[model samples]
Target: MKILLLGQHGQVSRELQLLLSQGHELIVLGREQLDLAETDNLRDAVRRLQPQLIINAAAHTAVDAAESEPEAAFAINATAPGVLAEEAAALDVPLIHYSTDYVFDGSKPTAYHEDDLPNPLGIYGRSKLAGEQAISAVGGKHLILRTSWVYSLHGRNFLLTMQRLLQEREQLSVVADQIGAPTWAGSIAAATVQLIERWQSAQTATWGVYHFTARGETAWFGFAEAIAAQLQAQGKTVAQLTPIATTQYPTPARRPLNSRLDCSRLERDWGVRLPDWHDGLLECLNASR
Candidate 1:
């Protein structure tokens, strides 16, 4: 399959490049080759490439910074996805796009389901929700995957930040109120590849929204402590982790307290479930060595 993937430098995109290259013809593009913010250029590139499948791994992911750059966030997150969906619709090909857990307001007591209503709390969430809506409105064969707390060895992520901070600071305070599963980018890429294979073989693919995340949940503080432990296991000096409330360390953009997603729909339909958060973290840390 000729797959045109957006966002070459992103964490997930980098993983996809490695996983999809095994048996597929993959054409990965960065901002220089295909800018998402520029609709004309993005459309032209998609038309010229005429890929069998379109995968959009690019997104404006600076959560706090997005508060001050609403236009930029929406342009890349919302407008660009819609444009890609439109082009895919025209070509009658399947479009695979990624979304976030921020689409919810964190009011739900339990895990969020695919049918749950979205009530985004910040500019970043709102933009992502808008993108999801736009793709659904475009009425094409698409897969909208909503994941949470994504981290990996490559690129800017929570695990990498924790490693650097543990080396620099003797002690650190992490938010304990905000909770979500830490998903590995490699796992996401691998699962996406599996889904593509299933979609190709099946007579009719299940095309809709689905949540993908590691099993179990943890607050930011717990995640930090886990990272610190991983570093310590590697014979490195680690920081003393301290739990702090969200109010103690406020950001420019508000975050959802409950980012837990119910991924049963994905597992039931596709027979694919990501590994546990701690397991994924350990694998990632091991891979980095």
Candidate 2:
């Protein structure tokens, strides 16, 4: 399989590069090689590579920063995805893209399902939702896998931040109002391979949006507490995690309180589901150590 993967240095992209290195021809591109903000460049790269599959892991992931840079975010997250979808459709190849749980407003008491109507709360969420719509509008063989609270061992994510803070500070406060599954990037990468394999073999495979994340949910504070506990278990002095409300820690962009996504549909259809948040966290922590 010839795979053209975007976002070479991203957490999930890094995992994808490692996982797809064997038994496949992988062409990974970073911002310098392919600036997603420039749709022409993205299209040109795809045209030049002529890959059998396109996996877009790139995104404008600056959540709060997107509030002030909506245009830039839209350019990369929205316009670029539409262009990729169009190019993939023209090439008659499959595209696997990643989205976020921010598409929902988090007002629902229960976990979000794929069928739930999107009601983005901030510029970042709105831009991501726009990208999703743009990709779907192109009518290609695509899979828009939406995940939440992504963290990893080798990235600027919540898990790494907490690890640094626990090492430096005696105590820390984290927002408890916000809730979601802390998905490991490696888990996402592994599941993505499964989807790609199934999609290649299955004569009739459903292609659309699907929520992929860890099996459980927790607030930011709870997640921090888990990190601290793990560090302590590893014989390291950790910080005291203090729970705080969203109001106490406001950001430029509003975040969805309930980012819990229902993954039963994905599991039922593909027989793929990530481990529990704590379990994934342990694996990440162990790998980092």
Candidate 3:
């Protein structure tokens, strides 16, 4: 299969590249080659490449930074997706795209489901939600897979930050109020290939939105503690972890207090299951070591 991936260096993209390259013709375009911000160039690139499958692994992922740059965020996260959907629909090919759990307000006591109404709390969430709407409106064969708290050995993510802080800071204060599963990028990549293989074989999954993530969940403070425990196991001096409330920390954007997403629908339809947050973290760290 000829696969055109829209991101070259993101955590999930990096994993996807490795997984998709085996036994497939994979074409990847980074920002320098095909910027999503440049809508015209993006359309032209997709049409010219004429790939069998289009996977948009690129996104404006700067959550706090996006608060001051709504236009730029929307350009990549909103406008670019709609254009991809249109082009994919024209070619009669399936488009695989990623979304986020931030689309919810995080007020729900339980996990958020695909059928739940979206009420984004900030520009980042709002833009991502808009992108999902655009793709659905275009009426294309697309998989809008929404995930949460993604991390990997590559890229800027929470796990890397915690690893660094556990070594540097004598005491670390992590937000205990906000909670979600720490999903690994490699796991997401593996699940994506399952979707592609099934679709290619005409197994036919219900097309639309789905929430997929690590099975279990935890607060940021708990995640930090997990990192600390691992460091201690390595005979390394770790930080004195302190749990803090959301009010104790402020950011440019408001984060969802509860980012838990239900994956029963995804598993029921696609038969894909993710590891627990702790297991995923261990796998990621083990791979790094």
- State the lDDT of candidate 3 residue by residue for 167-267, as single tens digits: 99899899999989989999899899999988888787588999989999899999889988998999999889999999999998999999999999888
Lowest summed-lDDT stretch of 10 residues in model 2? 197-206
- Best candidate (score: TM-score): 3
| TM-score (all chains, Cα) for each model | 0.98, 0.97, 0.98
- Candidate 3 regions exceeding 4 Å error are none
Instruction: Write the residue-wise lDDT of candidate 1 on 245-264 in tens digits.
Output: 98999789888999999999
| 6 Cα displacement, candidate 2 (Å) | 0.6
lDDT, residue 281, model 3: 86
lDDT, candidate 1, equals 0.93
Cα lDDT tens digits for candidate 2, 115-166: 9999999999999999999999998799899999999988698988998999
lDDT of 3: 0.93
**Every model: Cα RMSD to truth:** 1.0, 1.1, 0.8
RMSD score of candidate 3 (Å): 0.8
lDDT of each: 0.93, 0.91, 0.93
